[model samples]
Target chain A: MILEGLARLGRSGLGTLERLGRAHLLLAGMVLGIGAVLRRPGLLIAQLFNIGVLSMLIIGVSGLFVGMVLGLQGYYVLAQFGAAESLGVMVAASLVRELGPVVTALLVAGRAGSALTAEIGLMKATEQLSGLEMMAVDPVRRILTPRFFGGVLAMPLLAAMFSAVGVLGGYFVGVGLLGVDSGSFWSQMQSKVDFHEDIVNGVIKSVVFGVVVTWIALFQGHDSVPTSEGVSRATTRSVVHAALAVLGLDFVLTALMFGE
Target chain B: MMGMGKQRGIEILVGLFMAVGFVALFFLAMQVSNLSAAVNSDGYQLTARFSNVGSLKARSPVSMAGVRVGRVEAVSFDKDTYEAVVTMRIDAATDTIPDDTFANIFTAGLLGEQYVALEPGGSMEYLRDGDEIAHTQSALILEQMIGQFLFSKAGGD
Candidate 1:
């Protein structure tokens, strides 16, 4: 029984390794597929509409609420120490350093990523990908490249939008509603948050997340069985795996970027 | 899967989305971060040596008459002198500061962050880049002051 358990563990471990290798192969194909997107930019723009514009409302609303909550919580926490004037800096720093990119990536992974996997998996299920291949059109170039680049290009901008909106939300809560001095609120944040250190790093994190999330979504769809149930399973797996990857990579990235 | 007109509409909406995203990035860089508020790029550097910097760090404000004139660019240690060497970047716009200005570290409030305050001196010569301030006062540690107070009380007995 113990030997059987060990064998099962080894089999699962090997299966993970195999999947990792296949994901890298798909990544290479995607990289090579960029030429097709560059040749016809309209395809990429269409995918951008689906991936980015569609995701904006959720990103903006969530960002505003998150920032408002941060402001409210930060004010009360700092008030206990008579440091309420520092609320803007607190809110901006936390949002820029951690929340903005991370939350935006999480939202995109759930919104666009799942949809991407579902769409691609369904295409494969319906033999659409096979049809394109039979016609001598590379599905990876014709279909996958635009969608992948769309996610990659959209991520940093979405993260920036989230952070900007969130900062405004914090300002509204802290200065407009909570009686904090507006000058101190903005000036304090401006003085404390460095553009290169905070803002740029957050953008970098979001871009990395975009690449990773999109890569996972595309690979899962391409690798799924050509059936309805397989497409559904691949869609669910894309989200769960992308979320865990984002959170895990966040810790590693924070350590590298800000760890002293 | 859509007609040409519908496709063009999507392209327009995508263009709008891209424009809005760029605007948001601009807002982050300008208002949320200190990209626009940095000291002038053509600023000159001045150095000062202190016995103790306490919790003073690089990027701390350097002010004259409670108005910020520059920023602390770097904080290093002088191995030979056993002192802290601070490098400051003062805006070229404020080029009239005297050579004999005194640099002193002060806290904002009780248990607040430390900053360097400059007291100008009367001199015909103005400080230039690489010039070192002659007079410097280090940051005051509250615990050391309390310890000295207790020591003085015991000594009085």
Candidate 2:
């Protein structure tokens, strides 16, 4: 009997995977279509406000400390070589290229992704999703699409802000407290950063991360059974999956971007 | 119904606060970028040649006498000469670099950023644009430096 049950579970798992794969493709297409439509300036503006602007407080405060720590650590290492002025360039480049987007994505995954999963799960449990479907409305297009776009739009802007704040934090420590010349710090940063590529790459990474986080959350929420226990499970899975996806995607993007 | 209304109001307020904060932060970032640009404008220009570019990057500062006078503008490899050519923009107000000046690539700290430092020479001829500073040193990677330092210390012991 145990053997039979295990076999049944295996078959069900495969069936679920197949279903999820198909659902993912459909969802992807829908998300892309909705994203294109929402790219309209007015809608984008609303989304930017919802996703990017609102996330600044957490990003900023965290970024400040990140920058300070980077400055402190970078300064110590550079001091040994009597080359401390390069601290500005080091801090700026690292913040722009890697730290900014990765950190912001992780933070968003924790806060927004979890909330989205839980909210959707609760709505599903309360039969709202079913009600919408019965009314001939596509839940994926109406509910998931808006959230997916919002998250995708917000990640980059928030990441950029975090990086900027981080750099400022480094500046505060390097110039104000550490006695490194402020002029040197800023000049070094401007020289090192290729505003076009580095900044754009950061933004692009954030958008991708945002989409991934939203998709994972929605997927988990939609699949959840209509029970409180199921909702809790979905919430936990969404957060875990979103965080891992962020880190994994970051690595892949970095490898692709800097491979040459 | 009243409880739900109050909860919704709180959510809206939180959202509004986030929006306001983002705008304020973005404005601040723009100001910082402007300030950095202004600072860069005050620096001078200098050029150097290296055999290897390694991880050297532009916007890396050029310091002399513990003061930053310039930053790297461009990095390119000279195929014919088999050298890495780095052009730097120096602050106009700074004193001129002499002919025999030595350019050394150094780090800001351990695992920190790399930069070029110019040690001025007492030569009569001053460097001009397009003129290359003859003596140049490449960046000393941290691992290599630490390894050497440890080896030498152990050898002495």
Candidate 3:
């Protein structure tokens, strides 16, 4: 009798996992499709403003320090070979490919993603979402779409800022302080990096990361139980999930892009 | 209600500050990209003959007297001559390089990028465009340099 019960529970657990996977795919498809149709000048402008402008201070400050560190580390290794001029190429490539998108997404996930969860969780606890439904308003379109689009739009601009600042920091250390020739620095960068593909790829990754992070936050928040403790739990879960999603997606994208 | 309104106002102000900060950062990136592009056009050309191109890429600067005058524009092998000919573009404003200027392929640092350095000669005439720099030195490959240094030290010991 115990063995039968255990088998039943195992079957049910597998069934639940399958259903959860299907539901996630359905949600992703719906959000992406709706986002495509709803793309508009006003909506985009609002999203850009929320994501890019409002989050710039944090992103810029962090990026500046990251750039400085990359320069310092790259110099330590490269100076052994007397190849310091290549610092520009190293700095530019690292910023554009790995650091820019990943760092910006992580930052946004921590700051905006957490705030989004808290706000939505509070609304759920207060039954505000139910009130919207009673008033004949589409909560998905009205509430979730704006925040989702806002994050998606903000990510690319922030990543670009990070890349640029990182390069500048590298230049300050590699050229200005170390006395490496400026001409050599710029030449190495231009020759090695393809601006079109590398820059565009980074931007695209940021957009996808933004969507994933915002959706996870909103999903967790909207489903929270109607209690103070539930709201707090939801907020914490949203941040943890969003951060993990960003990291996992980054690895997947990198493999797809750079993997031979 | 007044206190709530004040809190909301503060939030809006913080948001506005973030937006302005992003705009400034974007402009900064644009400026740097422009600066790098402009600096690339200011150098002169010198042809270097090399047995192995290795990591030596085009747009690689050619330096002389510790100043960059041109960039490596193209690299091709002459089938009949059996020599690797690298064409470079020198800055117009710079003084003409003497015909006997020796070209040597050297690296920026130990593991850094490779560039061709020209040592100017005291000859009267200048090298015209398309003129092959006759006195050329090949790149001192890292392995060879290290091996030679080690072998000499070991022989002394």
Candidate 4:
């Protein structure tokens, strides 16, 4: 009896492994099929609009507010040490190195990622994915490729917007609102922030986050059970998973890139 | 379904967004950082050595007479000499620096930021490209000084 139970446990474990492996294969297939889909720029552009431009207002507004807040908090703390002149360096470094890419990724994962999962999940539930497959049109190529490339391409651009706006916002608050010297605010930031070290790393972070978030979104949508409830559940799962994945990957990437 | 006009509109918006994105990035590189010092100014290079650079980095200003004249271009270490080699890009217009000018790493606001402050000497000769600022004052870290001070006081007591 124990032998039989052990055999059953091993079989189920193997089954779970096969399912996970199959999911990876599906993602790989979608990745390989990008060349065929990318020939059509119209689809890619439309998806880019959906993923990035639609996110413009929220990212821009939040970026400004967050930057202002950073300025205020940074000034108060820096002033206590009588180093208010270095407030610009503090704000810019904090935003570019840590806040800008990570926060932008989290926001994008919430808005664009969830929308993608829902759209793709609904299509799968409605048999549209299979319908395309039946017509000999590869759904992964036609459906997934554009969204993946769009998300990946748009992410760095959005992150740059967030950083730029945040920096400006900090400038307004620190220099305009507060009594910090305008010259020092601008010069200190210029002197302290390294283009290669801080800015380029931030872009790399956003691009990595974009790829991972979209991959999770597309995979969860395509893998969910074919029902309305299943689609909704997958959509919810996509947002949660994408957020966690972005944060976790941010930590790992930070350790690898900046740690030592 | 969205109409063709609407789809094209969205594409145009994305295009505009990207254009602005580049502009913003340019502003950051040019105005908010010293990355554009290469393209924006014609400058000659100089080198200085220090025992400690502290937080001094590339693009830190090299000021003379309380006016900004140039920027630090690169920094490296001479392992054999056990000293830091700092390369500076002095603007072509500000080429009157004396050969005997002393370069001191000055801490702004009692330890906020560090820059090389150039104090000119009475020497008639001017420094040229590849000329070394033989005199350099390394950064004074507060923690190390405090540790030394505490140790000396305790020993004295």
- C-alpha displacement of A152 in model 2, angstroms? 0.8
lDDT of each candidate versus the true structure: 0.92, 0.76, 0.75, 0.87
TM-score for each prediction?
0.97, 0.66, 0.66, 0.88
TM-score attained by model 2: 0.66
- Cα lDDT for residue B125, model 3? 91
- Candidate 1: deviation at residue A250, Å? 0.7
Looking at model 2, give its docking quality level.
incorrect
| Residue-by-residue lDDT tens digits, candidate 4, A145-209 | 89988898888888888988999999999999998999889877886787777888888999898
Clashes of 4: 0
Runs of candidate 4 exceeding 4 Å displacement: A1-16, B38-42, B50-59, B73-84, B135-157
What candidate 3 gets wrong by more than 4 Å, as runs, is A1-54, A64-97, A121-137, A162-201, A222-231, A252-260, B1-35, B38-49, B70-103, B109-111, B118-136, B145-157
lDDT of 1: 0.92
Q: Mind sharing the TM-score for model 3?
A: 0.66
Model 1 over residues B121-144: C-alpha lDDT tens digits? Answer: 999899999999999999999999
Instruction: State in Å the error of residue B105, model 4.
Output: 3.3
lDDT of 1 by residue, A165-189 (tens): 8999999999989998999898889
How far off is residue A167 in model 3, in Å? 6.1
Native-contact fraction for each model? 0.87, 0.02, 0.06, 0.66
For B1-157, candidate 2 gives per-residue lDDT tens digits of 9977865665665466456546534543443333344354645456788876567787676789777777788898988999889988887766578989999988766666677889988898888766788999887766777899999999999
